[model samples]
Target: MIAAAALIAAAPAVLALDGTPGQGAALTGSVPPGTTLQLDGQPVAVAADGRFLIAFDRDAGPAATLLATLPDGQRIVRPLSVAPRAWRIERLPTLPRISQPSAEFRRRRAPELAQIEAARDMATDAQGWRQRFVWPVRGRISGLFGSQRIYAGEPGAYHSGVDVARPTGTPVAAPADGVVILAAAAPFTLEGNLLMIDHGMGLNSAFLHLSRIDVKPGDQVRQGQVVGAIGATGRATGPHLHWGMKWHDARIDPLLLAGPMTP
Candidate 1:
């Protein structure tokens, strides 16, 4: 299966790439140590061992380029084709419900947004991005990433995370080793009790609508460690864990990183 996802041509002498190059996919690659890497002209972080990670967003264009500049002035370019997926789109005949935000909501939401932005922007030394991710909780998938609904010709925001339906208080585990960046002390307007973890390499995970948070900011958590509990907090309708991930600004599909869930 991995071999199938790794669609690449001849690897250059200075670099090699692997993993899926599809939209919403993450690719891991390596280059000669000291090689500088860039994706679409943006500098990408390369570990001391030459390893690096890059990803395509769900709405990414058909192609991108990776440029590696070796220490000896050698340059290698790899053009990537991003395979697209058909998103699940639901259309309803009713008019979209638009409501004016309350003054209180507007006042409170600013700080919440600021806190979330600050958490995701933090850089940490955690190496969990190199590890294979695991399911935080196993259950029926309630919501899918990139799925959207439309009402009266108006398109709603696409789902940003994969939601697993579970009973309230069910423990949620860390998908990979990470440093806790934000463990919300109270429920936010939409996220409830949110927890953010930095897995390094510009990749991070956000667990939302949690009933309880077992970890706190600056805590180092390992894969499968309990970090929170499932809940119907925030704007959710029922108990579930909203597991969202991002590689820099690109929203990621947790189902891709963790693979098939098993008992």
Candidate 2:
């Protein structure tokens, strides 16, 4: 992994790229204010403070591109390298046809999908992502990001978050400072009692399978503040907490941000 302070000389502009370049990496970087940043020919949002986040998809290519255009019209292009990762796949014979959602399930999921997209689309310059992230709950890890299940020779959807095995009613805290954007107590079809928080600049965290939610939309929460309790709601088979994170619409690894968990 490259250091965050690595400087790249691009003739007219010296761009400093923070964070590693890999799958599920939410890299932060800075350019001159008013500079337009582009990733893979797509326009990327830059905060007023000159901070921008670059997100790598789980199956991103081995190489990527970054284009920066200064206020004076000078254009800088830098190619990026992305590292690949192996995923965990579980084979199940008794698994239902999860890959195909029923009409009723799809109808009920439309609004939920919209809400999740809305929460992730939020962008602010508060730098909440700059703070270190801590584990929301401590327990044995049962699932991981990008892991998938195979049923009857068909691959199902990848696991969207990391699952921590814990007893019911275990307190779940905010991994970092953020404003609550979603708090649904009733168990959904899949996510169960889902809660989402926006940590400024399109970075967000989601807690799933919660038994109870204490925070509501628009509520400010500090790091380590209790927001919910663990449970086996939704499709979970046992009491656990699913912690998912994202930068904009790109799904990132929460374990990467939280670092190693202590026993």
Candidate 3:
């Protein structure tokens, strides 16, 4: 639990400039017509309905602000109050040692990286995916976004996306309308059979460990559209879908971006 003094100290009196969160709570709000919103110095899109939202990184420390600019140039700042969360930390003693990839693996991974980079460089033509997002797949959540991980008994990177555990060949759908930026078959060291979509304005989603890709690059897809099938392709112990979302270079939590997942 967060200390009462911390919450009180973090909370602001009025909308003055940028608003910050308490500790772990996310910062979210709306803006006026024709105006933009920024949270933690990242630009957020304001929908036609005047709704806008931004999320803090799960590891985000205390002391951040949310800023909204009115159409008439009026600025509103509000401090955020975030509640602390108890995290589960595990240290494995017999983790497998990761060796350098073979030359063949390196040769196969290069093109895949190039393709993904090209997709990330796509231009934002319109605000098509700013609307509410639909679930790409329905299943039990096997992994959560922002959870610290120690893979194969070694200290590994933090989990950057949500993982859905489903049977192999389960259909994977688009979470929102977007252009298919990457569709290719490659050997990924971690994420296997990956596909990425661009949702405009530096927002993107990636589907990993897929069995089949139904969409192609440059194709326009709608929310709930079946884009691929799930599988255990790359480095995996079982069949699962690894869904990741990003804002420009920042790896925002996909679950935060889309809210809670449905069963």
Q: Roughly what TM-score does model 2 have, to 2 decimal places?
A: 0.88
**lDDT over C-alpha atoms for residue 120 of model 1:** 88
- For 212-234, candidate 2 gives per-residue lDDT tens digits of 99999888899999999999888
- Candidate 3 local lDDT, 117-223, one digit each (tens): 78898865435455667678888999877676565667667777789999999999988888888887564766788899888766789999898899988898888
Each prediction's total of clashing residue pairs, residues at least 3 apart in sequence or on different chains, is 0, 1, 13
Clashing pairs in 2: 124-201
The candidate 2 region of ten consecutive residues with least summed lDDT is: 1-10
Models 1 onward score TM values of 0.94, 0.88, 0.75
User: Which residues of candidate 2, in runs, are more than 4 Å off?
Assistant: 1-13, 91-103, 124-126
Better structure of 2 and 3 per lDDT: 2
- What is the lDDT for 123 in model 1? 98
